[model samples]
Target: MRFSSRVNAGAMNPIAAQAAAAKAAGHPLGQLNDSNPTHHGLAPQFLPEAYTADPRGPLGARQAIADFINASRGRGVDSANAPAAPAVDPSNLYVLSSTSEAYAWLAMLLCNPGEAILMPKPGYPLIESICNLTATRAIPYQQFFDGSWALDLASIENALREGNGSVKAIAVINPNNPTGAYTKLGERQRLVELAKRYDAAIIADEVFYDFTLEPFDGNARWAGEQGVLTFSLDGFSKMLAAPHAKVGWIEVSGPAEDVAQAERHLDMISDDFLPMSNLIADCIPAMLQEAATQTERVAARVRGNMAELHRLLDADKQSGDGVVDVLRSEGGWNVLLRFPSSIDENALGLRLAHDFHMNCQPGYYFDMQSNGFLSISLLPEPTQFERNVQIILEAVHRELA
Candidate 1:
């Protein structure tokens, strides 16, 4: 029995698996961990009434993708700075089954065995798993936490520099999972510059673009005109509130030359996999057209729940008890909660599930070592969320005080 050195074999982490086990026990362990929209009861009818349409074929696929591109371009994006349409042609708009699979294509395109791709710490773990499974290295970059997470450019630059240019790409989750901070326009431009200077690509996973609570009217314009190769990853996942829809996309944009080369390669790869899901592709335009209203509804819910969570934490803080402090949440469904270093978030998390019967995510899973972090799904039903959050906050008060 033998295996390639790159074979991480997709082993499940015991902590998460145990949590899943507790959840599967068919009772209330106050689930605060997962961010699955369907699990939280997001209704599919909120999407445009056309989700049931099926893609006709290759031409049908092209038309479905074209509609999204045309609509996105017609959204009054500054055409001078942005492409205002999908680049490398509409056929270049390769549809995929999920963002996880998109990462696989991207990882193969960007990194070779043992080569590195920069990822955020206190970030999503899937990138690490993908890199490990594919034999590429997932290098950690610090997302500085001081009330809010900021992209540490100096550290990112150092990581690329220190790697002797082995870093092929850098991943940014616009509304990063676990931590909901969106990269600022200024930061986005800076990263593009760094990517070109380092000769690397910036893979922007923007699945949560529409769920923003505040206005980021012009952020998408940052995609091009930066002289860097940028791939914008997005799809029906969040747009339709239909995670079961199984549709995600990667749009290649940036420098004229790099865009061409990236397109040729991406198209070839897409051809090889033929990964497009006909059902999901047919549903894109309808989802886009109909999602605007639901977007507002979800954003409001996120803000209301997050505000309530913060109010409780603030009350604890005023009492000189450091229960938790939410970092500035700009956009996205989850917020980061920092607790005292002595609190073993994992152990406390298990205790909360077993003893207090509440659910939450430990900070360590996202790579926080010293500071204890807790993550809650912002998409939970309000009435139930308030009850669960009360229990979570009480548990935090007990653990940290």
Candidate 2:
């Protein structure tokens, strides 16, 4: 039995690295490290009504899921007689404990050892680890940022043309994590076309899809209608502010023919893990029924926190210490605040914890080489977020200046 080298010696997952380092120092981390909701207090939203609802209750989880599938948005689970859920069928949607677990199944289903996929750098830290954990390769592309993040399409084109064409998938974090910028609608179209041209598939991790700070709502994207295939990932973790529920899903949307093939493969993979815990998987239906009300409330809190953050940053943007530009996001609970590269982020992160008692994430964690990219969660109540932001801003100002 031989082990692959990439899996053994690539950059370690940053979240895990931070946890280990924290435990080593005897100061459990402040935990701005992982995107899990438990850190930010989203566990309250994740409580499954089914947990309290009786097994004999007519409208408990099992029925709620059935009704939600029959509803318009849950097109993924339409009928049991059908081989796969219609995009509208609730049953077609498969939830995972975390997007990381979703990544595991996806990697195993798509790649063989030694095969690769083009992932964007300065992006999600889990992207590569997921591949490595599953014994596959994550070759990276650049998500360029001078001020706002943008795709370096030329590099993508070159990689696609230059490679031996072994790559079978490409991932884009729409309204990317760490970056917090939406994939431009025009760019989204181009991505679909690119996947088709390369004979590859798209995996859009849109966990942050509902957290838009933008004025307008992004569209309900469906790749199945287009000639290309895509697996759009999202879950209660972000949608319902319920990370404690451990509900995440991979949506198969693409051209009918390709989707059929993709589904055949994905269903087998999902079934292998079969009977996703009855608890949260059971909550999906009730969650959907109450989505309209719950989503609005969550969105309001997130929107308020985002607005407050901007007000503080904007008021001091012209100060002598220099300005920090916060990335404007369309959908997601986080923002990327970029600062002077002169100051080290990891050092600053440590200082924020020890000196200011505030926790913030460094940019490098996301494979972002540029320093001063800090990630913060919007789950904190308005007052807590406001206080923490000031601590970070003041620290960066004092340390860097």
The C-alpha TM-scores of every prediction are 0.77, 0.75
Cα lDDT tens digits, model 2, 1-401, are 11123222235499868886888799876744566454455556555232321211222443454455346455554445532334443434555566778777777666767767788887877889888877778888888765567787777767776666667677888767767767776677777777677777777787766566763444444423345677767666666667676766666666667666565566556556653655555556767766667677888888898889888888777565546767766566777777888878887888898898776678777878657688887768888898888888888877865
Candidate 1 Cα deviation (angstroms), residue 281: 2.9
Best candidate, TM-score: 1
What is the alpha-carbon lDDT for the whole of candidate 1? 0.70
Ten-residue stretch with the least lDDT total in model 1: 48-57
Candidate 1 regions off by >4 Å? 1-59, 69-89, 213-226, 277-280, 315-322
| Model 1: lDDT of residue 360 | 70
68-145: candidate 1 lDDT, tens digit per residue: 555654633446664453333554455678888888878877776888889988788999999998788999988876
